[model samples]
Target: MTLDGLPERGSWKGLRAENGKCQFLSWKNDFKPDGRFTITFFRDAQQTQPIQTEHGTWSAANGKNELRTDGVRMPDVYTYKLTDVDTVRYVSLASDPSGDCQEDYDFIERRIRG
Candidate 1:
């Protein structure tokens, strides 16, 4: 299964500009077409603890060209463009020009598969 060409199961680690893991998201699907998904979060760089746990269903946002995760916390939505095989930038969706997109993001994650 894939969402906008993203594999259904891959551990995506959030990256800082320096390419450090400061957060994470791992998705799992049962290989069904129900569009159902399970998301896990790691908010710490060291990966010692979790600020948000797994419980959600992620799918493409209709006509918005973004990914939407239902049943999660703050970042329930994300607009992304893959920069490379390993990196994907989850661009911000704020409608105002005054909003900052670089200082922080939904969390840009690198696909975890060597």
Candidate 2:
């Protein structure tokens, strides 16, 4: 059930591998149709221990092929590709100085239902 546009309103979860380690860096991103977003970082995969939370504004651009986020700490722009109805991959447009990983990796997020 792939949608023609971005999943504008939903909760998406993905594990971001940092410094080549992924087991400890997990996050959930909630997007709203009103262009607001909230990102919650967790110390564990189960998301029981939240480390930090950030708020930002997001929008689809370049004919819905790109995603741009504002007020977040990381890269602001990404080339988004939908893998499935509930899965999307975001490739950063710039390098993340805080990531410390040598290899570039795509951030894959899956939409979750409440």
Top candidate when judged by TM-score against the true structure: 2
Badly placed stretches (over 4 Å) of model 2 are: 1-4, 18-23, 63-75, 95-103
Please report the TM-score between candidate 2 and the true structure. 0.74
lDDT of 2 at 76: 56
* Location of the lowest summed lDDT over 10 successive residues in candidate 1: 23-32
lDDT for 45 (candidate 1): 57
lDDT of 2 by residue, 10-33 (tens): 899998765554344788998877
TM-scores of the candidates in the order shown: 0.52, 0.74
Best by lDDT: 2
lDDT of 1: 0.47
**Relative to the true structure, how large is the alpha-carbon lDDT of every model?**
0.47, 0.70
